[model samples]
Structures are given as structure tokens and as C-alpha cells.
Target: MYAPTPESTGSSVDDRPAVERLRHGDRDALTELYQRHGASVYWNAYGVLRSRPDAEEMTADAFLTLWTRRREVQLYGVSVLPWLIVTVKNLSRNRLRANQRRTADSLDAADPPSARASAEELAALDEAMALVREVVDRLPAVDQEIFRLCLVEELTYKEAAAALGLKHGSVRNRLSRMRTRLQSELGPRS
Candidate 1:
């Protein structure tokens, strides 16, 4: 619900001549246009954005648009407020869209994965796993047995150690070294 300002309330002369003056590069006419319509433009943008800084920026852009496109200036009856309001709406929408795009870009970068894996990611993971298996298969005999028992069979370190007649700490240390080697071979995760 927009309430008209004091300047907007009383009867005023037609603004077409001022617009025409602005078309002829009259800064006074531009200033007059701002004096007449700036409040409406600022408030319209404020209504949309609910932030003083954004509203002020939109207000400036709206006036800059008027100055840039002065040659094509048109008005409804006697007031430029309607044109300013429409320009503010368009500027506000554009700012909102840009902000949303930036926020979405940030979210995408942070998340890294979608609801499902893409073809490229799945193929890369498969390739990485194949390389890991190759590395495991090439391990020393005892190391290979420990890797299989601890990882493939999902045994606890203590359980694997007991089955293989090794100390629990030795089994843990071996598994840690194997994981480090695997990670180095894999390079980096996505």
C-alpha cells in the first residue's frame, strides 16, 4: 500500500516539456525530474528490497536509466512517477536475480555433489577404485592378507591381529600405512 508524498498530492503541470528538455540534454530538466519522482522511485524499490542500501542503489540506477534513455522518455499524463516506479521494479528484479544466481553458485561450489552422481564422477570413482584394487593386489604377501582381512572382511584391527598372530598395534599401524599409500596413489578426492 503506497501513500503519495506531499509533492505527489497536489495538481502539477504536465511533465512532457521537461522530458523534452531532458531529451535536448538539459540537466535542469533532469534535476527537476528527479525532484518530482525520486521519492516514489526510492520507496518503490524499498518496498521490494526492504534494505536501505539496495533501495538507494536502485534509486540511483533508475535515475541513471532516465538520463541515459532521455531521448525516449515517455510519461502517463502529468507525472513521471509511474515510469520511475516501473523502472525501479525492473531494477529490483534484476538485482534479486543476480543475488540469487550468486548464492546458487556458492551453494553448488560448497556442495560438490548433486542428488545423484553425474556420469563423469561415477566413471572417475570407478577408475580410482580399479587403481586402488591393483595397488592392493600388488601388496607384499603378509600385507595383502592383512588388507583383505581388515577391509574386505570388515574385521576389527584386534580381530585381524588375533587371526594373523600379530600385535594389535602392529595391525593398526599396518592398516594406517596401507591407507596412506592408497590415498597417495589415488591423488585427491573430488
Candidate 2:
């Protein structure tokens, strides 16, 4: 169910006006544009880049490029959405290529984890993970999504809330309840 969710439904109301000004060369258009598209743009970049730091940088770069080339770029009657999508995609690809080049040049793959752990250690880890998954599966669909985003994808508390269209405090409260339920099911592990 989470895999089928729509990331962006459409443009915002304020964005429409700002995009109009941007099309006409208004300098303040940049602010409006940022307000409208910032989150969506960052999410798109994050999907492709996978690194939070890089996704942030790429989103900024994509907007900066639009601002810098405002004169040269003509919106005509086109919606700003496609232009932004194309720009973010290209920038992400370029960043990915640059990263690949750097990694190739360095040839530095880090050392593997220690291999001395006993079979029981591995089993405990796997069992704990399975227990966590079972607890998550027992949650409602929306709560499952929030839990997955926070725990599996490692999104920040706020970021997971935004991605799932929930309030930050709501996310926290749901997570709290989820943890309590999971702990109850896990029982005392002494």
C-alpha cells in the first residue's frame, strides 16, 4: 500500500501565482517558487539520490539554476511542474555521475563488520528484527507507513510525518503507542 501512494497530488495555490510572476520575470517569484515546490523537489531528489545531504544540495542547486536562468527560460503557457521535474532529474543524474567518478578514483571500500559473533548472536538479531516487523504489520495501514518511514527508511521524525501527510506531533504520538504495543508483545526479555 505504501508503495502505491502518490508523492505529489498537484501544485499549490500560492505556487500558481508565483509561477505566473516567475514567467513574467518578477524577482520575488523565486521566493514563491521555493515555498511552493521546495518539499516536492527535495523529495524527488531524495528518491533518486538516496543521500539526505546530497538531496538537499541538489534541490538547492536546481532552484538556483532556475533563478539564474530566469531570463533565458520562457514558461510560455506551460506549467512549471514539468520544468522542475526535468531540472531536478538532470541535476540528480549529474550528481550521481560525479559521485560515481569520485568513488572510482578513490577505490576505497570500507572494511567489513567483525565476523567473530556466535550463531546465537545472529539468531537474536534476526529474531528481534522479525518481531519488529510483525508488530509493524499489526498496525493500521497509515501507522504502518509512518513506522516504516521512521524506522526502516531512517527519516527524521518531522520528515516522516511530512512524507506521510501527518502532523509532527501525531507522528510522535503514533510512534509512542506503537513502541508501547511492541514492547508489550516483546514482554520482559530478561
Candidate 3:
């Protein structure tokens, strides 16, 4: 869904020669490609992650991936920028998910649950979680992915849209409808 246009890289630069040079173990070709598209790739990562350090790291990782996966890299038209964009997008999302897991683990470790909680309370919590999962499972496949990316993964609307290749408004509207449906199904909290 991400069609590569002449403006995607801010120029009509052909990357075939550079890719060929890279595939032949030419480090200068890698440097050339980086100089050509590094900013676009970094900004793409930053747009998704909103963190300078993470974006910089992801930018480095993206170029590394391009280097390591040189033999397998696929070019769209004459430019390798599309492949780099997709790589950075994936790297940014992975970083986000890992950070989310680390935060959750740290929080859990910081605040051990009170052992004095009643069995009834634990059972109620389990039941509510089960109901939520069941409701989410009933959604269409794309909607289910949207839910996971937006809610469970905590990606911004723009990030989710870029990952899912949907428009920003479309992701926002679908998520709103999904929440409304979920609330209606679950009813008000007592």
C-alpha cells in the first residue's frame, strides 16, 4: 500500500547501482545510500517512535539491516528507499513493543500485588479479562490487528496507520467504533 513516489526520497535517485555495489561487499555503496536516504529514514523512525535516541538507534539498525540483508534486499522501481522505510517502520514497532513489555515488567516488580486480596476479586478480574478477549476475538481479522497494534502495543494512531497501511482517519474511526461496540457489549462497570 506504500507506493514509492519520486517525492518519497525528495528526489528521483536510482539505487540500483548502489545496491549492486553493496551486494558485492562495497562499503562505500552503503555509505552512499545512507547519505542519500538517511534523513528520510531517520525522520520516518522518529515519526513513529517520537524518541530521539530510539529513532537514531532504529536508523542505524535500518542501515545495518540493509547491509546484512543486502543479498535479499528487494528494490521497488529504481530506489531502495521503500525497502528502508519499511525496515525502519518494523524496527520502530519492535522497539516499542519491547519497551512496553519492559515497562510492564518493571511496574509489576515495583508493586507486588497484595496477597490479602480475596479470591472473589481475583476471579472477577480473570472473568473480565476473559470477556474482553472473547469480544476482541469476535472482531474481523484486520480490526483485531488494529486493536492489538493500537491498544495492547500502545502505538499512536499515526504509527498504527503506517504499520497497517491504512489512513490515519480510517484507523481512528475504526478504533472508535470498536470501543463503542465493546462498551455496549460489556455494559457499564458496576
Worst 10 residues of 2 by lDDT: 3-12
Per-candidate TM-score against the hidden true structure: 0.52, 0.47, 0.55
lDDT at residue 43 of model 3 (Cα atoms): 94
- Say which candidate scores most in TM-score: 3
Local error of candidate 2 at 32, Å? 1.0
Tell me the whole-model lDDT of each prediction, alpha carbons only.
Answer: 0.75, 0.69, 0.83
**Which pairs in model 2 have colliding backbones?**
none
Question: What tens digits encode model 1's per-residue C-alpha lDDT throughout 132-166?
Answer: 88999888755775786677555667755654546
Clashes of 1: 0
Model 1, residue 168: what's the lDDT? 95
After superposition on all CA atoms, what RMSD does each candidate show versus the true structure? 26.8, 13.8, 12.2
Residues 81-150, model 3: lDDT tens digits: 8888998988798778768887987788775466455889889889988988999999976687678778
Can you write out model 2's per-residue Cα lDDT over 55-145, one digit (the tens) per residue? 9977876686676556555453434656666677666765676577667755875445664567999899899999888878878866776
